[model samples]
Target: AIAGWTPVLDVCVITGEDGPHTALVISAGGVVSDAVAPPGTPHLRPETITLLSALLIGDWAVADASPDGARIEARGIVAAYAQFHLERSIRSLGHIDRTE
Candidate 1:
């Protein structure tokens, strides 16, 4: 079993040409999983599927060059995830120290 916090990130991208696309990313115990849907995927607007697709397919150039709202959202998600994990790890270490 994965013994760690798993945060789900919802990233949306909106551009002048394409509408909006959304991608759901989940990271658990160093394993990453994601899913991207095209336009008209229930409550999500079609935007960032292109960016997610690029990342999924290992198109670094496209993903890196993406200058859209998705990029900002992605960065924020990563920061939050890192902070959360760091805090959790620190707390876990403190508990271990107290017990020992």
Candidate 2:
């Protein structure tokens, strides 16, 4: 995720019972090791990532602008919003050939 930030997803895992049981995974950790969403879950909304980036970085400008996760530099900010499905923005965080 972000250089020093992690992703956050409100997951509600439900199970069958007399009524119903649900487990919410609000925060896990870095995507490098944790999985927030399930394997069957899909990551299609970029807005979610944007809001997450804002919450994680406490920067509205950055978060509002990162709703797309386009540039490689923007992956961290995006992944910071996705806990289990952090792969979507991984490719964006590539090696930058800029030393200036």
Candidate 3:
């Protein structure tokens, strides 16, 4: 969680029937008092908390669109965060230079 941000965002990645699923635990009303999530949720802290919080606050529509639920669900929050917030559109990274 970033400084001055609440209600204590906790994220988790769990294997589901389809694949990995991201479970979010958000504190109620941005307050810590009612922050307890439902049972079986993992306690996770994002490495890039400020960036993630900014993304969540600004670009939720882009962030929610993922190929697979598992795609955005990872123990490494950076990948998930980047895929959702940083990625602009799908594009080929490179093309084969087949002149050999």
Candidate 4:
């Protein structure tokens, strides 16, 4: 029932006081790595930023972003965990009408 555009909601993970928002994604090496792209884009620039966001949490701080991928303090599922939460959130938003 959480409606309205919540900026904080959009913020799936806030590592530090002011850090670039990020979500988790599978890397080319098949690792559940931090997002290469910033949040909310399609392909990589998806408007729906849940896939990555669902795995993040509040305490994790943005460690770095390199050719490898985004880095954070959190580990394993706790870090990669945001995906499930995001999936649910995206589902809650419901379906879009493509019948135009």
Query: Which candidate leads the pack in lDDT?
Result: 1
For 1-100, candidate 4 gives per-residue lDDT tens digits of 1332122324233232232343433321112214444454322222223323433332223222211222222323222333444543344223644232
TM-score of each: 0.34, 0.26, 0.23, 0.19
Looking at model 4, residue 30 earns an lDDT score of 19
RMSD for all candidates, in order, please.
12.4, 12.4, 13.9, 13.9
| Model 4 misplacement above 4 A | 1-5, 9-14, 24-95
lDDT of each residue in 3-95, candidate 2, tens digit only: 643433332223212211122232433221123345543343345444554656588686556534333334443444453454455444356
Q: Which 10-residue window of candidate 4 scores lowest in summed lDDT?
A: 63-72
Evaluated at residue 23, the lDDT of candidate 2 is 21
Clash count list over all predictions? 6, 2, 0, 12
Query: Best to worst by TM-score, what's the order?
Result: 1, 2, 3, 4
Candidate 3's C-alpha lDDT? 0.35
lDDT of 4: 0.30
- Candidate 3 on 11-77: residue-level lDDT in tens? 3212222311223433222211123436764433332333344455776654444333322332234
True lDDT of residue 84, candidate 1: 63
Alpha-carbon RMSD, candidate 4: 13.9
> lDDT of all predictions, in order shown?
0.41, 0.40, 0.35, 0.30
